[model samples]
Target chain A: MRIKKLSLQRSGLAISLGALMLLGACGKKVAPPPPPAPPPEAPAPTASLSATPNAVDPGQPVILAWQTTGATDVSIDSIGPVDPSGQKQVTPTDSTTYHLIAKGAGGSQEATARVTVNSNQGMQSTSNATEEQLFAQNVKDVYFDYDKYDIRASDQGSLQADAQFLQQHSNIRITIEGHSDERGSTEYNLALGTNRADAVKNALVQAGISGSRIKTISYGKEKPFCSVSNETCWQQNRRGHFVYEK
Target chain B: MSNSVRAIYRASLIFGLLFLLAVSSSAQDWIRTGTGLGVERVRLAAADFKGSNSDAKNPELLKTFNDVLWNDLDNAGIFDLVSKSFYPLQEPGQPSEVNFSVWSTPPPNTSMLAFGNLGVASGKVTVQGWLYDVKNTASPQVLGKQYADNATSEAVRVIAHRFADEIIFRLGGGIAGIAETKIYFVSERTGHKEIWVMDYDGANQQPLTKLGGISLSPRISPDGSRLAFSSVTKNGWEIMMYSFDLNRVVSFPRFGGMNLSPSWSPDGKLAISSSRNGYPNIFVMDGSGGNSHRLTNDQGPDVSPTWNRKTGSQIAFVSGRTGLPQIYTMESDGTNVQRMTDQGYAVSPNWAPNGQFLTFSWMRKYGPGEPGSNDLYLMDIASKQWVQLTHDSGRNDFPCWSPDGRHIVFQSHRSGGDQIWSMLADGSNVKQLTFKGSNTQPNWSWK
Candidate 1:
């Protein structure tokens, strides 16, 4: 009878242990650890620039077009900052290179276009020519009447020659320097000098030379080619001298 | 300290205090007694200043100060400075040490005496100057001044100038002396012509503008704060302004083509010549180069406008209306035109401070085969009566007036090349101010 009572008590303790283990397993099932995270992504963008009708006569306008994608800011050299995709008209005196830069969160991308200017006078063949050579062969000083800015009939031939040379060498730039004799006041002579130079420039434009190829300056009475105070010397001083750009 | 020695020092200090008080109270009663319309220069003597300290530097500095003071008084045009050899053997540095009989004796026989004491210590300079009227035996001292500054050559020269100006003011019939004023000019010393400044006596000369190109026609503002000039840049000749206070080139907007020859109005408005409208003409703009309005509309050039400081309404300029440039005066609005120079070629007119006369460069015999020589002339505006100030003195031009209206500073080619010169308003006391390379276009300071 004592052995039978011991077996019954042992069975009861086993059943209670089994019930505690079952409750612990159910709580573990309600909350579990999450899976590992995925890797990060990489960023990117695309941009390009192009010029249409890349070559043209001097003073003729050229159109510049650009395109970009996913860029926060975009800019073209000399054209300043611009929209991502745009078109612009430019009239450049010389051959120029346009570079476009597009910036984004990831990085930046760049592209370039070159416009080759065609000279009307085949100046590119003599790109390494000196100013003295150009001035001596193609251009000559134009004379003006005393205290007058009007282009004299005698100087018309010289202006015609200058215009022809400029039309042939479209890329070449020239400065029309006006000077006056030391007979009048220094300040008044300066104004007269300007008028003389402007007259020459206008004559060149009328002769089919582009105005963009010409610049004007007046030395007044300050700078005289002839220092003698005679009419013969004064006539030489009152002239529109030509200077060629390299 | 010994009791006897201390008692003696206290008694001397009290006596000194009482003497200073008497001098201070009597200083205001002293008045200049010379007539302004006299040909006689005030005879004066400048004694070597006593050295307060016998240090090595003190003697040299004292000599510099004394020499500069003597030279200043000698060149003032109003003084007959006594030679040092004829001065009294005793060089009295203070009123107490001066003996009236010694300077008033036959050899020097000076009407006035200037004496001072100078010292340098601890990198500082100190001076005590006194001007004594030799004829007034009872109250011999006419002026007393004390100056102190950093112990430098410039400081010493400045102290001497200040002392000399005081003496000139006291004896120059209430005329403010130009010793402390400056002369602005253009110098080609540095290869390129640039603006430069010097003392009125041409002592300290230094370049003010280092612009790498040509600069001309420097005109100082009435307040002496800005210098307006013309400079050549890549664009062409443009009017430029240099602010003395800022010590840099200030922005003066270009009004387009070939702006040149800027003259400041009495109220600081700029009167500039511009070719913006295809021809050069006089235009007035605000000091900051805004609010521009055409003052003259002639087809010929109208430039070099100088304002009448007395009345800001009138302008004197060079007009080429009658074929050749001549001096003309008109209202500020370009109305009521009247020609001052009837026949000769005249330009660069500078109105006097009192506005009663105009000084300009005129060639009496202008035109072909004429013996034309540019000389300075003074014209009475009301009567048109003119007097030639310079007689064949080699192409003198750009005459500017001193503040007192007693002297004129001008540029002359008398010495082979262009140089700056000054003379009395009556064409006496001609003195060369600049001897350096090719200096021209002198504009005296307003003060």
Candidate 2:
């Protein structure tokens, strides 16, 4: 009701002003001039960019939230262009500042939020216990056939479980250690062990794990889990074990 | 009449002495001297040195020096060392005390006699040694040597080795004996396989690399300044070069694969077997790990490369291209491929100093359900005719040629665990070198 009354009053004022201008023009000796209309006002641009829980531990993820008004194009620094108003999850390895720019007809407006990453010392000391538990309880040893590096059908389920666990704990890094039985040449066994570890790594990568999160090592016939000379012991020695980094 | 007869007798006597000298000198020439039917072993006698000083350590040092010298000459495979029990009761401590008739007699007939005087004072030892031709009564001394150092066990051993080397150089037809060379091998004494170095005769065994991981296939550089071996690291199987000058492991770039069995070229470039391309192949790189180039491109695994020290133009390796691991040779540029072994599993080919033969480990009948015996075999490269040097003893492998090409050192499991053993090139005079903690893969130093 207030908006309607204001419009009515504005229109009435406009009509009275027009009538006064007409009378003045008629009294003038020269021809009446044309009345001028006011120009359209352009909208001002605005932006609001912020990080949810702006402080985080190392290798932890943070959510970036942003909103904008009257923007034809919106962009975030270090993230390229994004939607005008949306949220994104970023896992920064170090402390970072995110800048958002909203551009419109009036001009551009910018907003920034800094995500602070805690130092590496305290986190390292705390993560060791959890990492040890993860390695001891979750990671399993993958076995291989004699003189072979291929992933056997029976081991696929265990490997899948491992991959899922790795995905869940994205901040953890692991080392895949390959071993071989004491039957072949030391050098050849070393190569075979590497192939075994690489096979495991490839399986993890195929299951949507990053290669950078894993490393591989071969202990060919050198570090045997079982020293007995029998098929049962040999099978036990030929394996791929996982070690977590603290 | 009396003066003329006397002059004539003097002339005849002079002529007779000249004839005797010519005959003795010719017989003393070691190159032409041989046993009844084959190459004769030089008969040598090492007398117990007399102690000149009573420093409480002189007797022990002298006994040690005498025993070491005797064992060195006896193990040289070219000498017939007279047993000390058969030696004359009189112990000659110097040239003046050496009675030629005692050593040249029938009971223990020796052509050469070694006598010396050893003394210790204020933690220092001095040794004066002399080698003499027992048959040449007048001017019997052939070699005179003097050595002095701090009275440590190492110093005593070194002095003995030096004196023994001098004797071998004069008696073994100018071929230098390996008295001073070291054999680098892998031992599990520390609960993990580590690179250990010992004297050629297995004395002073010490660990060279304490990586606390499996380290194997230790190949000492020709210059004896670096040792190249493969160890298990977090990165993978990497070739680690241990610099003797730095006394620590130097940096070797990780080749991103299974790098093992590094063999230095005659020029110090390292040739290693790597699986960087998903197949085990030979890759040659500089000692500092630069300028890498592939030497073999085959689907089968190629490994255990040994360079021909004579020309450095050829390499011998083991390849599985023929369905089983066999010895193969190719030029340094990877051309002119030639397979040396026709059948059986042959690996670890070491070329002789003359480059005329190759010694390797072979299983005559290799495969499942076949009776196989791993033994050392020597093959004439030109004829491809091989002679099994080791018989139905235990598993014998990793045969390396001595610097003088007269002997071979290898690892044998005949006595229960793998131990380093050395034998003549003809597979005679087998002597065990190391007995502790399963030693294997011995690399004889070039010098």
Candidate 3:
């Protein structure tokens, strides 16, 4: 009877050891793979544009428009080529809403006009504007001369009228974007674009506009309105753009 | 061996967490050497002939002195001579009757007065030239005249160049041996940039090294027995110490990375060069590349270290530690660091043999966003004062001093392309020396 009890105790101990082994096998740790890096953020899309043409002639019209997003204060400037294009900042103009255009890190976007400029029609003042008139906008393409980073003499009178509109409506802000042709290196062109934007800013300052109200940046030799490999397209490519921020 | 080992050990133990700048906000678009591509210019005035119309019959001999000056100056590569009758673009050779108003209006980069007296058989090439201050000819400082053997056409070039040297010397500049000196540079007219020895000014550019790989940064030893330079082959790049006296080549103590920019000790006992040690720093080795000693810590970047003979054991090199490439002085074994300049830019500090002043590029920012606006400046080592040397546009760099300490050879992009140039130590008489494909990296051979 005592021998039988010893054998039964030994079997009980073996059963316990088997249970421990099964538990160890089932509890083996396994690491999960690292979470994949978050996908890159997509650039914001520009929903709409607001264009306002102040001056309109063969030389190029004062293009005032709005990206409606990005940038705090937007403004327009013009250095005319009336005489040698040397030190000629914004020709005499009468506009309320200044031109503005801005670009972020992704694809570039331009603004349409906040004021319609019938190319055939001359500069018009927006003095006593109704709510409906103030809200209306247009879309037009303005051109620049070769190597000249300024609003053409033809556009000044019109741009000034747009400036008058902005002055009347002080609640608005805008960004001035400068652009260049693709003939030169990108780095230099980028700098050139900045120069163009600054040139426009200088004109705005002289025209009694607060510099703090306008901001600027250069897109360089990137993005073109006309891609045809010709002088005509390049002329269209070099420009000082205006887009409304507010 | 023990002494060298001790030096190395001392250098290693003293190595600290040195602060150096490899990347900087003010990086030079061009590795400016602070010298210009100045070639000495000479005028071959037609021997004023005055006799009966028949007396002009023997005008060729009268023109002999003029011919000699032309050939010699041409051979010397010192002059951009327009023969009163040979320049292709001119009104057939008559220098358009020196329109002083026009020339004076332009304010010539160099001012020279050439009055020639060429008469019949007594071939006397008397060139009374005055080297004036480039910025202002307030003083008719340098004047020289050459009296050569009248009969021979060959020796006239020599006598004229001698005259040029005298004037050059009087201007507190260099005595360009337009009459004798030769240039040793790498010419890739062949597949590789081989060592080519040519006339000082730029004529007779010939290739010396036939080695298949790339050979550059050529140096003429103190004795000029062999030319030391860097070469790249299928095996690797090496700081090659070639025995020119024996026409043989041997590379010393090959480091794992690139080895170049060798500067021989004052006594020719050691050659210091840029060796790869995680980064480029100065290393001193014997002629055979034995007993090597590293002189610097892991600084950001160090290259173009030249010996200052005045200090004897100190070297002036370009270091990029302060967010820009500036001139710094360290012991030959890389200790005792000191800064040199604070304003604008400095590079390629070519020390005078006397070590009183260092020639470096000092490019100051002129307009906003216009950064490459730079000029050559001379810095007095003791006073830490700078004398702005070059004022005009274009690039001027790669300054190498002459043995006499009066002249410096450098690469200047003044003409829109790189070429060799020389000027006085006092920042005067910048004359272009080369008119061909981008030639640079000049080292003067005293021999």
Candidate 4:
């Protein structure tokens, strides 16, 4: 969705293009000096984004996370924002976006989070969805090494915890989808992905989960979360998806 | 075990100790530096060599079988030189068959049993073979093939060997698991295909790099520590060095197109292969991935280069400024470019371990529509003579000499599958190394 919006906005204004290089392409390879910087700039001092779970109805224990770029001080004006001196409780009016307010010598800036939220869908995803994620909680992407199927030692601990929770909820069966960066062929990636999922399955199995309870499939180089071809995009794409099923 | 496997096994032992010796095993120690297997999974079955064949077949090819007519089913080595006391028969011709019951059953406790025949003079050769159950010779299992005049003696040898393999494959019981070795090749499988590694039978084939991004002709380094390939990855793809040493990869430092075919510089210092100013040409780089020097400025795609360890100055590669891909050689620094074969189009040249002759592929024009036929050809650089290693079955390309120079592993369509096949260096004793997926690109690990 964001890609479509980005594309439309780019095409509509004929601006900020990446590949076609509307502006950058013209100036390069020639003596033409780069055009002067335009007076209008993007929201440069955009505020940081954050979220905090406030209410808990038996299962929703809130957690706090923030994204900050330009400021050091953050304040919540309604429930009013967090004050170092003690004001900490605030009711979430919408999906939480920690309001960050700050003052710089040159200017003043306030940042708001682009925290969009939707309640967990009726059915959990077969891969890449967490148990708590059923409540629509935030989760980060898991990564893998080139051609490696085993989960990193670092990721194993968290995966173990996830496995334990799944064990507690016996009604759930999960599918671990293996993925790979577009560095190799589709079939090879598929096999590599399968290897990765198998690794994760091994881990879950070793951590007291039954083998039959878990299943796997490799979507080799097919479904990439990130489309760029560089290492970063490859890193994002070389990932195994976790979906919780009930 | 393949000679190189033993060396790698030792090097890896050095590798384990090198781990104990850490810091030094880096480029300075010259260890292979590519990603290695993560964990060890030992399968008693894979390690099982299945031992040699049963020493039971009694009726052997006699010194006297007649020459006869041969085939249509199509198809398709231990050494040592010393005059023996037994007076082996004169060179063979189209051999005739023998019924087991009438054969000269050798004396008891015979130290040696020679059961082979040849039929060269006649328009045909018949190799009559049988499985004498020794104690049960009454119901012997017989098998043999008759070859037509056109059957190169080489095919007879191939047919004969296949006959041997059948006895072994059957007597040895199910699949020797050989039906599974892989073949590695540089295929235009994907346009701009680079050096690719696959099963000896070419099953799970995947490119080592799309990172070479474009065309990258690769050759296994002499020390068996790296793959020296030319790539456009650098800048427009230059030559670069890659080590099979690192257990994990860290050296694929996207070259600026400064690296090219990397024939280990004798002492394993520099690589030799074609590079470009604008075309696929020859160039050399430090085995350590530094100090690259362009050796050839030929306009055509000068490729498939091999290094002569003995002469130091000898470089062999295929150049096409003459219109078609043919074998060409030069001095260490690229001077004295010499064209070796002038007959049929021959390309993909690799040194025959001993370095006397370079193995290459030649296309014969006979089958059908310009029906290009690719066959393995080995030319003796010194003799100015060439020998066709394979024929009729199908195109046999990418010949890699075993480290001992005694055996050569190559890919062929003879078995109706593009699989890797091996034969005596002289092109006798052909055997399929793989039986599964189509395999190609055979780089013999040097001992």
Q: Clashes in model 1: which pairs?
A: A120-A168, A121-A168, A121-A169
Query: lDDT by residue for model 4 over B12-111, one digit each (tens)?
Result: 4554443423322322110111101111111100000110122222112121121111110011122111122322233112122323222223222111
Give DockQ: model 1.
0.04
Where does model 1 sit among the CAPRI classes?
incorrect
**Candidate 3 C-alpha lDDT tens digits along B1-447:** 656655554443332101001111121111011121211244322222222123342355436444444544443333443444322221111122333332223323234434334333444333333333323335433443436354444454455556555543443234334345656765555655567676555555666788866676777776778777876543334677777666777656666444556777666645444434434556787767778888776543455677775465778876555544577877777789888876344666777665666777655542112345456766656556555667685676657766655456777778876677776554556667777665766777753
TM-score of each: 0.72, 0.69, 0.45, 0.38
Cα error, residue B38 of model 4, in Å, equals 48
What part of the reference interface contacts, as a 0 to 1 fraction, does candidate 2 reproduce? Answer: 0.14
In TM-score terms, which candidate is top? 1
Candidate 4 chain B weakest ten by summed lDDT: B42-51
lDDT of 2 by residue, B121-160 (tens): 8888999999999999988889999999999878999899
Instruction: Give each model's whole-structure lDDT.
Output: 0.77, 0.79, 0.51, 0.48
Each candidate's DockQ: 0.04, 0.05, 0.01, 0.01
> Candidate 1, residues B22-89: lDDT per residue as tens digits?
43343311111221121246889899999887666888888789888987787666788888999777
Tens digit per residue, CA lDDT, model 3, A86-133? 111232222223333333333223333333333333323344544335
For this target, which candidate reaches the highest lDDT against the unseen true structure?
Answer: 2
Candidate 3 C-alpha error for residue A64, in Å: 29
Kindly list the per-residue Cα lDDT of model 2 for residues A51-166, writing each as its tens digit.
97899987788999999998876877568668889999998765666766676666567787878778766456547657667556556678786666779775787789799989
User: For candidate 2, what is the DockQ-based docking class?
Assistant: incorrect
